[model samples]
Target: MMLPETLREIIIKSGFIKQEDFDGAVKSARELGKNLTDILIYRGLISEDVLGQLVAEYYKVPYISLSKKVITVDLLRLIPEEAATTFRILPFSKTEDTVSLAMENPLDLEAREFVKRKTGMKIDIYYVTAPDFTAALGQYKKNIQDAFTKIIEENVEKSIGKSGDAVTLGADIPVIKILDTILEYAVAERASDIHFEIMEDSYLIRFRIDGVLRDILSLPIAIHPAIVARIKILSLLKIDEHRIPQDGRFKFKIKENYIALRVSILPGFYGENIVLRILPESTRPLALEELGLIGHNLNFVKQNIRKPHGMILVTGPTGSGKTTTLYSILNILNTTEVKICTVEDPVEYGIKRVNQIQINPAAGLTFAAGLRSLLRHDPDIIMVGEIRDKETAEMAIHSSLTGHLVLSTLHTNDAASTIPRFLDMGAEGFLVASTINLVIAQRLVRKLCTSCIETYKPSEEQLSYLKNFLEDSELTHNFYRGKGCAECGNKGYKGRVGIYEVLEINESMRDLIIKRVSAEDIYKEAVAHGMIPLLRDGMDKALGGITTIEEVLRVVRE
Candidate 1:
């Protein structure tokens, strides 16, 4: 059965998907003869857990995530495997008179009745996502690590004494299987990036998990060349040319899901060092509010992006999620009536209906040139990936002044620094003051693991440091932090969230900019005008239990 419109409305009201996307998914579901839930999950418009939660909320049932749940053999024996498989259910826990069962379709009367009769106890039903349910069902079989060990052992023996050229060795079945297993393990561990480092005697493989790198496995240096060659073959790079750096990308699949891997290989002292950035192919741009834009910052971005003509600049150092913020804004403004064009150094993700151009400096199509062409194309909104030079900066400002909403990024420490950065690029004071609407500076901090987050009163020194930014801070206030837990791999952090400072250019700030004031002076003026500083925003989040003070300090300056 299809997802009811009421449940779709619940998801939309919860800010997970837009009305237009939901309607499109509904139409696509009809055309493809698939249910609405499958279409939404397949398209990555909404995650399975979130959709399941919405479904549970609509049905007034409990929702559960089976990711970290451990099901014992005795619990699995509550219901027959055939019945569980046929009904798409799992018996997770059991007591004397009650059994807790997780089901993908809790509304199915047949499944519930079958489960109740089989268990002969009061069944505590929990709604779970399809992926989670399927994964839970796999717990009935062999252990995941055991399966990996078997594959690795068999492959290592197969390649023990085989001698061949790098290309030939790479084409070997054992190397292929080993590489596939490594990739599968990385995906299973939710790695954002994979690093292959060559050493004198060995090759080390590490996965960057939650922004931290940990060694996964090591192999003999003998097979390093074969591994490199295999990666090059997969990414379609030249195997013979290891002296020069090469960049390429390829898609890797695990089950029904596909991951887009961006490959970067550089010649190192030992050998070629490879780094792969893992991006899910089906993922879409997240909503603004979901990007950790809370309260004022959230409201400010919402209001400013809707303006007919102005420039919004997101500033941060490398890997601070500046591109993500830009994509999110573009996602909001993307519509049929308003044509949005972008010129990126390398286009990251393809957004539907937005005209994207990759900047090819070797081909003479720089940001300035592409932007100039876009202006001739008569676009309502423009996105320049970065304003790296005076020419592109001028063009972006010109576009904003010429009745187009422009979004782009700059490499600056904070919101206040963006103004001075523009002036340093030779942008005039009046032009900088007039065309810019808002400046957002952000940094990503690891979020506290919710499953094991604990709260405690801050120390006197910590309280004093936090009070420096917040005036109304109290000494008795308790802040939250994540203790080590299995769910977070004992790191106390699971994911990341952005701490932002949004500076809205007003009359006084514009005047200060036109007068060419120092960045510090502009920062003070913006603070007086209700602009939250990055440290203050981070502290606010820490106080609210979203992250720890230490995590905030790790990224933002005190």
Candidate 2:
């Protein structure tokens, strides 16, 4: 009898059973019976070995056993010295031990553990060879490389096609293949953004991957307009209408994954300055704790944001991840109980539980106008894409004071800089102080790939720079740097993490704002009140191997 026969008997007794249901029965039997194999065999359902194999498969792990009938010293020697060291296997016998070893696979940790514990001696394990190990390893490596290459090519085709912005060449190699090579290279390098600039004779393509600009391959200038047009088409913008700047957005679906893209086009000296915001499909909404905000700060933000009134502003420069942060917060607060509405220039990501509006300024549905109309619908939480003008800023402030929880973005260097930015927009200090609840200034830095990081003592000049900057503060003597590896696409870095500085306005800060304090002065006070500067936050993450020092310097300096 076999385990399958036992399974069949159980099924027949039950009339019929699904695999999952049968597994449940097996679990119950194991709990109630002694010597599970013997019980099955006595019941005329399974053989000992078959029962053993079933247990192995059920656990999805290799099985190893050492009965005095099946241990061998030659098998122990067959395992590589490195493998033995890793597994902590000790050599015990000069000749083969007559211990029977039963395992689904030789490398099973549980099997090894069982043998070592039962035998009270070290066991050597050997795997069956299939003619050529080196050749197999080589083939596996090549397959991985080829798979990566295919993924890259596929991504390029999807992005280009999504944009509808590349000239198709009906040649042997699709132009998309070249495009995929370039983008895969950029993404693999962990670039923050991709830039395409047109010159006289050539189209210059560069990737701001990892906060550093690297020149990618260039194309002939003749194809510049075609590429631009292709992008315009993909974005759903009118490709022929180039007289005025046009903006559009669309998503690219590749391998059942979707990426959000925002395209902006403006007339340039040589051609059009086109910027594409490539938002990967895998961006998950992180919780406040995950964002590295301290306990007090996290509590403050969550408490205030969860309230029914006031405005929360997330301020940062272009490409500083303001939108992502906003979206993440929105996701946190989104529920069926509240009415949330957003007016974006071009909505970046879709939220299931909120009403989202895309601004069509071309048709006179400006942010201010949209907000005014949105007020009629009675939203509990209002998201203004950006307070770009005095009108929109005034509207956002007024909305906050009118009992709506307003969220918006402002282009400023730091949290305190939001004050000066509002002032520059003709927003009175009193209005700003009254409406503002929280301001989060953030930047994105490229994290170092942990799989390929190297640590060293700081250079004298680097130490001097740090000393000069920190003055009396303590500094770590050693720092880590990224060394390019296959895992990180030879870029040494992987992805980006946020360096955030959150400013929660209390009565004191509001008073300072009402007094029209300078941004630098306000920043000073915020720092004194335990607001971590973006640079310091970046440095902390760098030390933790979350990002590289070079990336921190590049973004913080900017």
Which candidate gets the maximum TM-score versus the true structure?
A: 1
Per-candidate TM-score against the hidden true structure: 0.78, 0.66
lDDT of 2 by residue, 221-323 (tens): 6546656765665677876676788777766664455666677788877888776667776767777655655445576678779878788988878878788
Q: Could you tell me the C-alpha RMSD of candidate 1 in Å?
A: 10.6
List residue ranges in candidate 1 displaced over 4 A.
1-90, 93-146, 458-472
lDDT per residue as tens, model 1, 1-558: 477778767888999898899888788667534457766775678877788889899878899888788888778777765577799898888889998888878888998888778777898889887656755665654344456778877887787677877789889999999888888878766788999999888889999987779887787777788888899999999989979999999888887778888899999999899999988877789998778897889989999999999999999988889998999888888888889889997777888998899988988999999999999999999999999999999999999999999999999999999999999999999999999999999999888765456556677777777766556534455566777555566677878889999999999999999999999999999999899899888887776667887888889862
lDDT on C-alpha atoms for all candidate structures: 0.84, 0.66
Native-to-model Cα distance after best TM-score fit, residue 538 in candidate 1, in Å: 0.7
- Clashes (backbone N, CA, C under 3 Å), per candidate, total 0, 20
User: Model 1 residue 266 lDDT?
Assistant: 98
